[model samples]
Target chain A: MAAGKPVVMVTLVSSDGQSFQLLEEAALLSAMVRDTIQIGQGRGPAGIPIRNITGQTLSMVVVYCNKHYTAAAAADGDDAADEEKKVANKKQLREWDEQFINLEQDKLYDILVAANNLGIDGLVDLCCWRFADMMKGKSASEIRVKLGIRDDFTSEQRAQIEKDSPWVWSRTT
Target chain B: MLQPARENEGVWRLSVWCFGVDAGVQFSRCENPIFPLIPSMAQDGGESRDWAEMPSDALSGVFGKLNASDILTGAGLVCRVWRQLATNDPTLWRRVDMSCQADLVENMKAKYAMARIAVNRAAGTMEAFSAEYFVTDDLLLYISTRASSLKSLHLIYCPYISIKGIAEAMKGFTQLEELTLYLSSFHGYVSEAIGRAGQQLICFRLNNAFGYYNCPVDDTEAFWIANNMPELRELQLIGNRLSNDGLIAILDHCLRLESLDVSRCYNVQMDDVLKSKCARIRDLMLPRDQDVFIDSDPSDEGYSYDTDAMYDSEY
Candidate 1:
């Protein structure tokens, strides 16, 4: 509550009754959360309930926030030891992120929804990027199967979709 | 004994039937509950190997960064996931720079039309239009219908375009901030058309298009300027038949004028126009060889003018 304190803590409660407490500066990376906190004016610490996120997803969100907070703190301190420590910490966080994002389709969906609900822009972007990378060399039909998207088209419509973009099939195989 | 055995068997069969029905209902309910579970149950079903699912909004953000060609050939033809994303990404269709591919103008037009549809669907409005090559009046009219919310337009070496097409397009673009037209064969009619568009044009560049020879040596240009563009900040006119009087008329009218380029306009005297009229002109590109002749005697109509200076400033 002190002026120029440089850090404010916020409590986020998930749908499955999991609590996530994070430093406000780290959470401010998400524009939506930052704006909400500014509007709330220190009332967020009482607990801002995120109704759409599950417990597993909320845990992942907290891990991301904690890592970012520690890295930012180390970088802020003016010393060679702090600088070296920050670099090592950043590398470790990057590895953790790479491993953490390797989730199953259902879990990934849950994380994406949770990230959106929590207003975590970095997590959402990372998940989206990962999805795009998976889609890079896949054919249209293969993509449909992978995503488990129902074939909404009738037989005639299916033929038309393929005929309209024949290069999609020819290029893949 | 027989009755007791038959009752016991019937009860066992009834329990099995009820259990089967319950299991079927549960499987149906859990088939695709917000997320698919089959990928996790497959051969490579671990969190470390399975493909991560993305939200639609996030997918749209990624698609917005792809270029026009990539969007058309690669992203557009991809599965429903990518096709939907690419179709809804407005930034992909913002500035269609079709100047470099002069030979593929026809192909580019078809591509532009497709891109416009995608852009309109995504952004609800197309804001910017740029064409480097010669665009016909028909094409311009076609563009105007879709791109009603256009803010900036750049056209260079487009000879087929007349004043009428530009005027029609300008009527819809009430929010137009910048307009650049170079090496066009338009005359006073086009200038008058621009005046009637009712846009507070900030930057206007009309070079090698409107001259005295292109129009009658009357007060057509002056009248057009006075009526139309009062808020014009930058004006570039090259090889135009703007005399000292005409230049002064423009200066008096456009009060907010900051930059003026009247290079190769030989009819106007440099000292009279530059010093008196365009004092606010910062970046002026005029005939370099022309010198200021401040004569002691004013009434010297028969004084021989230097032809060398005229020949030197050939631009």
Candidate 2:
């Protein structure tokens, strides 16, 4: 978005008939929105319909896109910013991303799929990292419990997996 | 102590089963058959894919962030869907890091077997492999036969990885970019072999025993690298015996050198001329730069906690 250019606000309707208006530049972060905008579907009274994503999920996505777009625009605008300040800004954004992504297992899964469906690669990665972080240093049973995953393996199969890599479950820490 | 290869048949069975179903789908697109053993998969049937019922893309996205140990233990063992994904996914095994849990594996033969499993899982697309104490010459030879696409090889405290074994393996790793060896007995011939073969090598870290008093220093390793790998970008020769002459030789030859960390190389005096020669390096770390490479519990033995922690350290 160039300076002095009129801000193009596009209304995005969710799966459950909920509407949210966002800046065209910010909404472009989602590939689905970008495609819709490219096809000139976002100019109507009904607005662009984001399929599958709910009002709650789309709102979260909008928050992320809005935050990242502002940060990115600020970063681009400050061409002469010192390296230290740039690093600080990056750290702040990272902190914000972490905070925003810190959700429960169910909500996290919702965002993960939403991000994936929207073709938001960065959000997908963040959600994946958050899940990975949650799963780290935990046993299979512990992880299954935490993530509400059903253990479909039989006793024999479980034993075989354990026998193959005994050390994976035997760490002192 | 060698377990028969048949021991891994169970894991292989599941992978083969997955392929069987997939191949079946390819053979007859109209038929949506569900195999009895892998019950109710319900994939590709307009079903909403969730965490338990994840698509390969999202599953791989999660698996990509996990380390080898996490995948081997928790993430890969969650359910049948995850188990199948873990076994069949080649990208997951690209950078097989057995170094982190090297000490946990009781015997060298068992570790070798596990390494074989990892390499086999990679299915010839393994790019980077890092292993510690348990790696033997035979294991290296095995990896050489399998992982022809190997680009980065890090062998830490693998005293059993003899010069002959590594040299033989180097023939397979023609595309190697980063080669790191920590507390090894690799002589100059290995470096010469790497220089000869790994022309595309960029980052070479040959860290000897850091924080050790009166450690032997020599220029042979430096000369081998300088003469062979001119395209080297980052070099960390911590606690090496590389003298000022060796440093000069490296500086003179490896013109594309960007970051050089010789933090514990006591022989290389930071003289005015030497500093001027190394002026081109952007991230130059001298011997007296807080000794960032120093480990308090540096030992001659295989299991050092600090050295294990050093696996993630910047070199």
Query: Each candidate's lDDT (Cα)?
Result: 0.59, 0.75
- Tell me the interface RMSD of every candidate, in Å: 14.1, 17.1
Cα RMSD (angstroms) for every candidate in the order listed: 14.8, 13.0
Return the lDDT, model 2, position A79.
65
lDDT of 1 by residue, B158-236 (tens): 8778777777777766778778888766644556777545348888887674232122233465557656788888887
- List where candidate 2 sits over 4 angstroms from the true fold: A1-3, A153-173, B1-50, B100-113, B186-189, B193-195, B210-218, B269-276, B287-315
* Cα lDDT tens digits for candidate 2, B125-149: 9999998888888888889889989
Fnat for the candidates in order: 0.08, 0.42
DockQ scores of all models, one per candidate? 0.12, 0.21
With a 3 Å backbone cut-off (N, CA, C), the pairs that clash in candidate 1 are none
Q: Tell me the lDDT of model 2 at B3.
A: 18
Computed on C-alpha atoms, the DockQ of candidate 2 is 0.21
How many angstroms is the interface RMSD of candidate 1? 14.1
Clash count, candidate 2: 2
Encode model 1's per-residue lDDT on A34-103: one tens digit a residue. Answer: 7777786534455667676655566667777777766667666646567677678778877878787876
lDDT of 2 at B273: 94
